[model samples]
Target chain A: MVETKVSKSQTKSTSQLEKPPSLMRGLMLSKITSWVLFILLSVLAVVQLLPLVWLFFFSLKNNQEVFNLSPLAFPTEPKWENYVTVWTQGNINTYFFNSVWITAASVLLTVFVASFVTFAITRMKWKWNKLVLGLFMVAMMIPIHSTLIPLFSFYTTIGIMNHPLALIITYSAFNLPITIMILLGFYYTLPREVEEAAIMDGCSVHRLFFTIILPMTKPVLATTAIINMIYNWNEYVFVNTFISSDRFKTLTVGIQNFIGQYSTDWGAIGATLMISIIPILLAFFVLSNRIVEGITSGSVKG
Target chain B: MLYDFKKKGEHEMDKVMSDKKVILLYVLPALILIMTIVYVPIILTGYYGLLKWDGIGEKTFIGLDNYSKLLTDSMFWKSTYHSFLLAAFSVISLGAYLLVSVILSGKIKGSNLFRKIYLVPMLLSSVAIAQLWMKVYHPTNGVMNRFLLSIGVENPPLWLADTSIVLYAIFLPIIWQYAGFYILIYYAALKNIPESLVEAARIDGASPWQIAYKIKVPLIAGVIKVTIVLAVVGSLKYFDLIYIMTDGGPNGASEVMASYMYKQAFRMNDFGYGSAVGFFLLLIALTVTWLIRKLTATKEEVQY
Candidate 1:
């Protein structure tokens, strides 16, 4: 309540200053220019949204209707069956499951590993902590594309080719640096007194981490988990290169196969795209605030 | 009492030391994981670039032959040039869009709604966006041509089908998808600008365009630098969108280094050549990022 009153007062004081007539007119002209700018931005925003909107309209049309009719026109008959057809024939149910399992496992592993590492580095006085942090920063600079072939070769040599766990491991490795960086930032913000008190109460390091630190860091963990889950679920190149078998394919790769070189079934493609994005959308909706905070904080920092 | 105190003090110190060790143990697992997956693979890529091995065959020493070939390879040079063009287009367009959006965000009604809508494309997978654009750029019945025809512009050029326009055509979807991200960056930066500055400028008879250019742009210059660096790196390493949309098609007009490398390694089974391409890409990205940093290095620390 006090904070609200302070903010309200600040806002009031900030808006009270007046200007001369000429200055007011300049401000008015600025307002007019701003409105013009707003309209132009709105138009551009609509153009940006056009593709997704087009996807929805095309999804409702059958192949014959899609090819023959106007691309932007609403379907004469909304073929809702296309959704079912794509779901069934595209093996999206299995792909969805694969995506879920891979994403969930990868997120869980990455967050767990990253948090543990962050907990250790920030809490423990290790001599090589700076070195370890530097190593992770270097890891971020190495583009994943450069390493794909070598990783595939190594995975094939190990005979874990087409294994879901292999993909999970790869995702976890790539995701670790970002997760660690985010969790480290969160951990830094945490007070040391609680952990110190826990230590005095004869709490084991493991118990302390599980009971106190983990619970306190839930928001950051959730953000990291969701971000990792989104990336893993939507990732195409690695999954496509690593997982060859239809059984092991994630939704992104599975959906890609729907679009052959010869022809693309628009309805099926749209449905598959929708199905593939549902998990990410669901996760985003649930954790939108945390995700937004995490991205802005994480990406903006050096 | 003295014996008890001594024992307790030893126990506390031991606990401190043990806790430190435990922290190391916690960090060790992740450090090892990253090293094996990231660092080792990079070193191996460099090593493999020095060898002449089909991915399936026995490795043979090739020294710097692959790297030398990359220097002279027309296709490699073409793709590099194309990547630079794509990066330049993405940077300029994205920067412009971001600046416009940031200015609009100030004192605009429903700006929050606009921001949310603007960011939707960023949320969609690149492959999906690429596929959607491929449909939009279709030759006979594509939306682009249809719109052009409706506007009475007959004989609209084929987008992806035409060799000349294919690279730019592929770039359109990428720019559309990524512009929102930079806009958000600029928006966040713009929001950090003190309202008093704008108000003061207004009271001094400054127009909005002048305020935006002379005030907001200068303030958010740091973000612009970062955006340019990210754009350069991202475009240089771009693959999925192009691969999905055109597969660097219409006589390889849309090929970038990463896609070209993928074709070389996977399609042609020329692992050495692919590695060279990858190395060149890495070299260029790092050099450009460094150059931008050096150029944009500022004395004032603008807190945002």
Candidate 2:
């Protein structure tokens, strides 16, 4: 293919330009040079993690100690009760539960719907397939702010304003393009032979997709699922603008108001933030590779 | 006869797979929903900018009035400048990310762990990141000042409260949150360069710096361009953290386009004006994305 040949020729220059290195290579290869670069990288890594560490320390400290002690020091006695109090007394419990269900519903809808479209475009035959896919892809470029006002008025007019359905629907709709993009690459990689054999065995189109093709795409599905879950869980602007009441707010919006109420209580604020981020942190611990892959594939091609 | 019969059965299977009804069923759900929820609203936002009505009241047509007002609005222009400034800062910072990523991709140990740690700030909600960073910037009992004090600095200027320095202070966490993402992207790209090519470069008289600058960076120019588009347009839509952290505070010093639009709509109750701001943001985002892609685009693909 021209594509393969083009890339080979691009690398050919670097491959063919070889000659024996000169004596100056000895000084250039000195150990100190690489070590200095390594140390710089290590500093960046530490800087990235320091704020969370500082947050944890402050989370355990009450006002007396937070005011008196060093910002980085561990508290003499950890007050894990800050977590318990924020969970029980404040509206955090409601927000936490709301986030769980909304995130679940939205993730499921997004992945399934994205899977459906990806399946159709890559496998099933259609005339306007590329055009439709283009529509979804271009939708990614349209900023959400552009859509917020009309969506707000539309939801209000339709009488679904302030409802969880509003949040779930918007999440599902907005996330569709990126989800489809991630899945599209995987779907293209899938062999058509499996679906062909199933169709030869008299399997219906729906069954062919749901049973034969979908199972083969599990790894990619997981990637898209995790991506969707993170976005849905951390979403802010939609919930803030659309939802007005306290009972229905997600953690992002909820925490903003919760912190506003508990403004002076640094321990509780820190504890609340820690609780909100733990799931994502745990998820990263498990699936960092997939997240890296999904983000790269989704962005690089765009 | 047997061969003909088998071929006929294959044709039947192809017919079922390409069934029009099933294709519609599969794609239409997503297509219809996006049309109503995403595309329709985008069109409406442009239209909404033309009206002189409150969000709840009857609409009155005012052709180009809000936009004309926007053309001369100093506050709006100021916010737009702040947004562009943030975008410029983010794009310039990518060089540091690229440097770190290049170093990491040179067969380093524990690079995976390093990338994950860098991404931790990115995973948290903006509100949570904002709240944690608010503490980090706290004047009296915060970690930043504590460090400044320990280092023997005479005066630790207030971070979030100082108008001139507030925007830069917020940009730190933006760097923290996105540094991992860009690094991960760049690292992956660098790793994609073939080992044989690098070996060939090494055999020649080129040093590591030459190989990195002359060879590696050129190969990943496409990815670099994509990140530029992302950071610039993304900065235009900057809201959550700024809204949660300073709320465009210290006398609107940190106001970006999205946060300004939010304030006009939600705080000032000027729905028409806010729509104009939001529409302008969308236009700005699209234009910048297009312009970056155009400027960075190559006629012949930079293969590999």
Candidate 3:
């Protein structure tokens, strides 16, 4: 009797489960919802990509075609010469080289200096390590706008106003706090026994850092390099303030001149933006995973 | 043999320490750089605030004059009020958006794809985002107005042109660009919540809302605090987008503290008043951040 009752209850529960439409029905509903979501997401993605697409399309269109035709529609004939014209007339080639040189110099300096400070703080026995860490944190909190006026004054006094190296140093210094924080996290996670063994083997502090610690921390260094590169490459405010010459203007400022007084040439403006963003996009695409990891680590902690 | 080697090593270490000064030498470059770049600028700004000088000229002492003028400056007050409003709007909207996105991120397939799509705005430079949105918000030929018109609305408001609606319009783009970041943060925190608790709640017939409120929200309080702090700080310092979009006006309606100060310093060349505005901004940011930290302090340790 008990077995019969139990079987009856089990059957009732199973029937209830199956009663809310068949399994096929449930699957169909889910499939429909998933498709709907997929379509929605795709539309959103396209919307996000529209600006870039517009830029590319405009870049290939002449100024007359751009203004005369629908802005959303493709050009009837692609003007390939516009690219050549923007490259030459815009002085983008010089700006591109300037950006590359400045970004590379800044990245190298930041990575090296930040890694050294992080290594000393994390790995070595130092009396003032805590103080240094606190200082970096405070520096990170201080807004750049507050210091810009005074910094301009100071830079002018130092006679390095338009110099690329000066900009590199300033960028590196501004970027060091976050870089050190990131590298410190990676450095602290390193196994202590390796450093101990190195010390036991009579490796000096400098040698130990250069040969052992830095090699293990290459992933983070690469991450830092990529981040600092993107920042310095695209940085507008500092570059705008510090460098005024046409020859020395970074891509950010150089592209701004495209929007001249009366009317912005949409075609030229769009083309310049596309050209300027290419290097950054390539770098981001290559180092996307590292970038994600670095940002998450820094952001979550901060 | 061991004792002899130990004695010799001790003597060598002493010699190395005495001769090399390794620690100081190693740290000197970073120290000098930080002192010059970070500390000196901060100190100098404060000192410069006391003087009256343009970018080119020498200083004249002006004791408390900038500060006194700041008290009565209608523009300064308007900018601060706008900043507060922006902060409030951002925190509330972004907080809700992040919460919804985090919940959606969990049950959805292709969540990483969604994350990457959302993160595009954050990855792009602020200038690019600003310019792109400017096109979208264009009055006659813009996509937004065109869409509104297509939807059978007879007229669409001029976004940045309308003084009343301009601040809110500007606010939307900033929110769009940054919401993804907060979504990622909240999602990370949610991922750390043990699935067992959620499953247990489900078995107990707890609804999704109940599970979220009772389990997830309380569990991820630390992350929420951090998100709020970041949002507040970011909102206060927001300038690039506004600068590029409207230059803080059709009629200074969208002016925030940062933009106002930038205009005062660079455009108006009022270094003295600009310095005052800068200090005021710094003070407000610091005070708000400190207050948030104090308010959010808890003794209960949050375990993953």
Winning candidate number (DockQ)? 2
**lDDT per residue as tens, model 2, A118-224:** 99999977799999999998888888888888988999999989999999999999999999999988889887677777887788988888888889999999999
Query: What 10-residue stretch in candidate 1 chain B is worst by lDDT?
Result: B9-18
Candidate 2: the clashing residue pairs are none
Q: Pick the candidate with the highest lDDT.
A: 2
Shift of residue B253 alpha carbon in model 2, Å: 1.0
Worst 10 residues of 1 chain A by lDDT: A17-26
lDDT of 3 by residue, A83-167 (tens): 6777888787888888889889899998998887787677666578789888887776666777778778888998998877668
List lDDT for all candidates, in order: 0.79, 0.87, 0.76
Q: Write the per-residue lDDT of candidate 1 for residues B1-304, one digit (tens) a residue.
A: 9999657755664577356568767987798889878888777877888989899889999899998888899988898899999888987896587666666557777776676667677777776777778788877667888889889998998898888889888888888887767777678777878988878887787756687888888887877787787788888888888888878887888888889989999889998778777767777777887898899899887763
Taking the tens digit of each residue's C-alpha lDDT, what string does model 1 give over A1-302? 67656654654466554322233445467558767888888898888888777888888887888878888889988988888987887777788899889889998999999998888777767678788887886676666768877887899899988889789989999999878877878898898767666766677888888898999998888888877877787788888878888898888888888666225677877777777766656766666666666665555554
Which regions of candidate 3 are displaced past 4 Å?
A: A1-47, A63-71, B1-20
Error of 2 at A186 (Å): 0.8
lDDT of each residue in B31-67, candidate 3, tens digit only = 7787788788767767677778787887889988888
For model 2 the local lDDT of residue B232 reads: 88
Off by over 4 Å in 1: A1-24, A261-264, B1-20, B196-207
- Model 2 TM-score? 0.94
- Which residue pairs in candidate 3 collide? none
